[model samples]
Target: MKRVLITGGLGFVGSHLTDELMAKGCAVTIVDNLSSNVMTPADYPGCEVLVGSIEEVYPTLLETSKPFDEIFHLASVVGPAGVLQHAGVMAQSIVMSGEAVTRIALQHGSRLVLASTSEVYGRAGELRESDGCQVSSDVTVRLEYAVAKLTSEVAALNRAKVTELQVNVVRPFNIAGPRQLPDGGFVLPRFVVSALSGEPLTVFGDGSQVRAFTDVRDIVSGLQAVMSSGKNGLVLNLGNPANEITILDLAQRVRSLAASKSEITLVDPKALFGPLYDEGIERVPVVEQAFSELDWRPVVSVEQTILSTLDWYRRRLGLSQHESVGVAA
Candidate 1:
C-alpha cells in the first residue's frame, strides 16, 4: 500500500479526506492535536493515529526513516469566528505549522498538498487561483485567516520552485456536508441543525450575501485528482460555481427540505460575530482550471448536499428522517 500522511486528519475536511484515502488502499497516518474537532483513535480503527500537533510529531516521524510518499498538509486554525476568538494563537500556529510541514515534505521528498481557504480572495468576484487576492490590513479575524493562508501558499510555491517537491495548493470554497460542525460559523450545517430542531434559521445582513456551497465529497475528489495530475506549483480553486445561492434562499430551501415548521429570521452580523466581522459580499470560484487539469466537476447538486447534511444531522441527533422529502432539484 502507498504510505500517506495527513497533518489534520481528524478535522472535518481532513477526516473525510482520510476516509477517501483509505478507501483507495493507501496506508494513512493521521497527526492531530485534538484541539478543535476532537476524534479518538477509535474513529479510525485501521489507521495510525498520532495525538500531537504537526510541529511536535513531524520530527519524530522523520527520525523513524519511514518516509511518507505523499503528505496532505491540512492543519490550521479554521473558521472566521474561531480565528477571531483566538487570533494570536491562530496566527502563530498557521505560520509555524506551515513552515514545519514544508520542511518535512522537503526532507522526505514527498508530494505536498496544502489545504488553503477561499477567504484569501476577500470580497472579490469570480475568484481564480491566478488572480491576485484582495485583502485589507485591518487586523480582523477574517483578514487574519486569509493573510495566514496566503502566506502559506506563497511559501509552498516558493519552495516548490527551488526543489523537486511537487506542491499543489487547493482553495476550497465553502465546503459543507455531513460531519461539519454547526458551531464552527459554517452556515449550511448551522441552518440544517437549527431547522431540524424547529428553531429559526438565522440569515445575516438581509440575506443578500451569495455563496457557492461545494459538497465536501466533490472537494475530496478534486484534491485527489490534483495530487495525481503530476503538476507542480499549481494552485487550483475547488468549488462548484453552479451551486451559487443567496443566504436567504438557502435558509428557506433548508426549511422546506426538512419539512420543518421553523421560521427564517434575519439578524445583524455584528450581533453574531461582533463588529470586527466583515462579511464577504459574494464568493464564486472560477473552476475552469480544475476542469481542464483534473477533468473534475462537482456532480452533487446543492439541494442534494443540503438534504444529505440534514439527514446526517437527524440520524446523529436521534431524530426521524423525513422520507417524504424527495431529492431536491
Candidate 2:
C-alpha cells in the first residue's frame, strides 16, 4: 500500500484530499495544528492524526514518519482573511512547514507534491506554471501569505534539485466545496448561507470582480492524476477553465438554487477587504500543461460544485436547525 503524509490534512483542501486518498486505498497520515481558523479532524474516521503546530511537531514527526512513498504538502496560511487575522502564525507556518516537509521528503526519498495557490499570481493575467509568482510592494493585507506560499514553492523546487527528490507543484485556483465555512469569507459560501437564510447577499465592488471556482473533488483527482502519471519536477495548474463567474452572477445562482427570495446588495470592496482591495485583479488559469502532461483536466462544473455545496450546507444546517420532531405525540 502507498503511504502518504499530508500537512494541514484537516483543512478544507486537505480534508477533501484526505477523503480522495483514502478512497484510492492509500494509507494516509495527517498533521494539523488546527489554528482557530478552522475546526479539527472533520468527520472522517480512522485517520492517523497528529495534533500540533507544524513548527513545533514537524521535525520530530518527520523523523519518526520516514520511509513514505509520497508527501503532499498542503499546509499554508490560506486566504486573505486568514493572513490578515493570523499574520504571525501565517508567517511562521509558511517558513516552518516548508523547511520541515522539504527536508523530510529529501531524507526519506519521498516524492513531494506541494499545494500552491493562484493567489501567488497576484494580479497577473492568464497564469501559467512557468510564470513565477508576482510580488507586490503594496501593503496588501494578504501580501504576507502570498509571499510565504510562493517562497515555499521555490524552496521545494530547490530542495528537489539538490536532493534528487522528485517534486511536483500544483497551484489550485479558488477551490470551493461542501466543507467551506459559511462564516468564512469565501464568496460562494457566504452567498449560499445568506440566500438560504433569506438574507441579502453582499456583493463586493459592484459584483464585477471575476474569479475561478473549482470543485475540491476535481482538485483531489488532479493531484492523484499527476502523481500516478510519474510526472516530477513539474508545476501544474489544477483548476477549471470554463467557469469564470462574477460575484453578482454567483449570488444570483445561489439565490436561484436555494429557492430564496433574498436581495443582493453591493458593498464597497474597501469595506470588505480594506483599501488595498484595489491593488490588483485575479484571473483564471490556463491548464494546457496539465492536459498534455498528466491527462488531467477539471471535470466538475462550477454550477455542480455550488449545488453540491448547497446540499451539504443545507443538511449540515438542518441537523443544527429546529428542535427534534420525533415522538411529538
Candidate 3:
C-alpha cells in the first residue's frame, strides 16, 4: 500500500483528507498535536498516529514514520483568529514547519503538498498564482500570517526546483463543511451552529462582506488531482465561483435551512477577533488554471453546501427532525 504522511491530520481539513486518502487504500500516517481537539484515528482505524508537533519532533518522527510516498503539510499555527492571538508562533510555525517538511520529504523521496490560504492574497484583487501582489502592509497583525505562508510557499518551490521531491502548493479559499469548530470563527459553520442552537446569527459589518467557500470534499478531490497531474512547482487555487455568498445571505440561508427563528445581528467589524480584522471581500479562483491543469471543478452548489453544513450542526446539537423552511433572503 502507498503510504502518505499528513502533518496536521487531525484538523478539519486534515481529518477529512485523511479519510479520503485511507479510502483510496493508501496507508496514512498522521502527525498532529491535537491542539484543536482533533478527532482520533480510532475514528479512522488503520491509520498510524503520531501525536506531536512537526516543528519540535518532526525530524525524529519522520525518520521512523516509514517510507512515505507523499507528504501533505496541513498544520499551521494560525487560523484567522489564531493568527491574531499568537502572531509570533504563527510566523515561526509556518516557516519552521515548511522547512522541516521539505527536508524530510526530500530525504524520503516523497512528493509534498503544502496547504496554503487565500489570506496570502491579502487585499489584492482577483488573485492568481502568477499574479504579483505584495503581501499587504496595511494589516500588520495579518501580515505575519500572510508573510509566513508566503515564505513557506517560496521555500517549497525552491526545494522542488532542485530536488526530485515534487512540491506543490494549494491556496484554499474559505472552506466550510461539517466537523468545523463553531468557536473557531469560520463564518458559515458558526452561522449553522448558531441557527441550530437558536442563538443570534452575528453578521460583521452589515454582512455585505463576501467570501468564497469550498467544500472539504471538493478540496480533497483537488488535492488528488494535483497529485495525479504531477503538477510539481505549481501553485493552484481550489475553490468554486458559485460558493461566493455575502455574509448576510449566508446567515439568512443557515437560519432558513435549520428552520430556526434565530435573529440576525450585525456586530462592529472591529469586534472581529483576527488581528487587523478589517471588513472586506474576496472572490474565488480564476477557473482557467484549475480547469485546464487539474481537470477539476466544484460540482456542489452553495445551497447544497449550506444544507450540508446545517445538517452537520443540527446533528451536533442533537436535533432529530428538520423542518421545511423557505430559503430566507
Q: How many residue pairs clash in each candidate?
A: 0, 0, 0
The lDDT of each candidate is: 0.84, 0.76, 0.78
Off by over 4 Å in 3: 272-276, 323-329
Tens digit per residue, CA lDDT, model 1, 91-168: 677877888788878888888889999988876688887788887867677787888888989988997888876799
**Which residue pairs in candidate 3 collide?**
none
Q: Rank the candidates by TM-score, best first.
A: 1, 3, 2
Q: Model 2: residues >4 Å from true position, as ranges?
A: 36-39, 272-280, 319-329
lDDT of 2 by residue, 181-227 (tens): 74436788888777767778888767777778889888988887877
TM-score of 1: 0.95
Best by TM-score: 1
Q: How much is the lDDT of residue 4 in candidate 3?
A: 91
| TM-score, predicted candidate 2 vs. hidden true structure | 0.90
Model 1 misplaced regions, further than 4 Å: 323-329
Identify the superior model by lDDT, candidate 1 or candidate 2: 1
